[model samples]
Target: MRTVDEIFNEALTLPNASRVLLVEKLVESLDFDEDITHIDEAIQELWIEEAQKRIDEIRSGAVKAIPGEEALAQVRRLLEL
Candidate 1:
């Protein structure tokens, strides 16, 4: 049988969508509170919609994209103040 660490390492190699699906399924399996599950699902849907909007904006050139390092540097500067 595969160890948990081995399975986790393999899961890390999956594409982002696959990883998200895997995580959702794992979380759902452990979720005992129906109310919390519903809330989590709603939040996930909102995030999915937001992410799609951002991707569309980037593709349409409606907004400029910044490099990751530059964005992180800006966040660090804000936190340091």
Candidate 2:
């Protein structure tokens, strides 16, 4: 019954690559478990809020959007496709 912060702190102490792998596994396994629905809902709400903040930044000219071609090229390079 560890708190999220405690779990996160423990994960943070892992090596950088292992921490990333742990996060990836956690994300992949995040199915709709009935016991953790409330926690999942809170996480989703935070994601929405962060997305809204990014949108607001773009609207306020605080962040610039990448051009489509440049973005596509970067994606292709990352995917090695």
Candidate 3:
């Protein structure tokens, strides 16, 4: 079995989407075992709704749009990806 450090080090080299998937799987493993699946699903749904709302707002000009590159850069900066 891989040590946590080994897994994490390898995870660090993954693409952003892959890293997110890995993290989600790890989080769900811990959370599901503890029976927090409902809470987890609720939070995930909330974020999806929020993101969709933001997209709609942007499309309607209710919110300003950022360049995709700029948004990606900000996410990478925040995540240290």
Candidate 4:
């Protein structure tokens, strides 16, 4: 029998579309006795949407941006650097 790593390596060689389908099947196979909670799924979706909105705002310059060095310096100051 093929080891898990060998199976994973073989799966990696599949085309993108095929790989996506295989992944979906693999995830579905994990649902044995426990069914997914709808509320948890909805909360996860909301978090994804909120993150996308924040990313869009930053990209569109709607939110003020800080330089990485400045942010790091502020963090270091908070840590008593």
TM-scores of the candidates are: 0.55, 0.49, 0.43, 0.41
Can you write out model 4's per-residue Cα lDDT over 3-60, one digit (the tens) per residue?
Answer: 9999999998887667777989997888556766886799899999999998999999
Instruction: Give me the displacement of residue 68 in model 1, in angstroms.
Output: 1.0
Candidate 2 clashes between residue pairs 3 or more apart in a chain or in different chains: none
RMSD of each: 13.4, 5.4, 8.0, 14.7
Supply the TM-score for candidate 3: 0.43
lDDT of each: 0.86, 0.84, 0.86, 0.83
- lDDT tens per residue, model 2, 7-56: 98998787766766787898889676558978879999999999999899
Model 1 residue 18 lDDT score: 74
**Candidate 1 ranges beyond 4 A from true positions:** 1-35
Top-TM-score structure, candidate number = 1
Local accuracy of candidate 1 as per-residue lDDT tens digits, 1-81:
999999999998887667777999997888565568777799999999999999999999999999999998886665454
Better of 1 and 2 by lDDT: 1
Stretches of candidate 4 off by over 4 Å are 32-81
For residue 36, what is the lDDT in candidate 4?
A: 61
Choose 1 or 4, whichever is better by lDDT.
1
Specify the poorest-scoring 10-residue window by lDDT in model 3. Answer: 27-36
Candidate 2: TM-score? Answer: 0.49
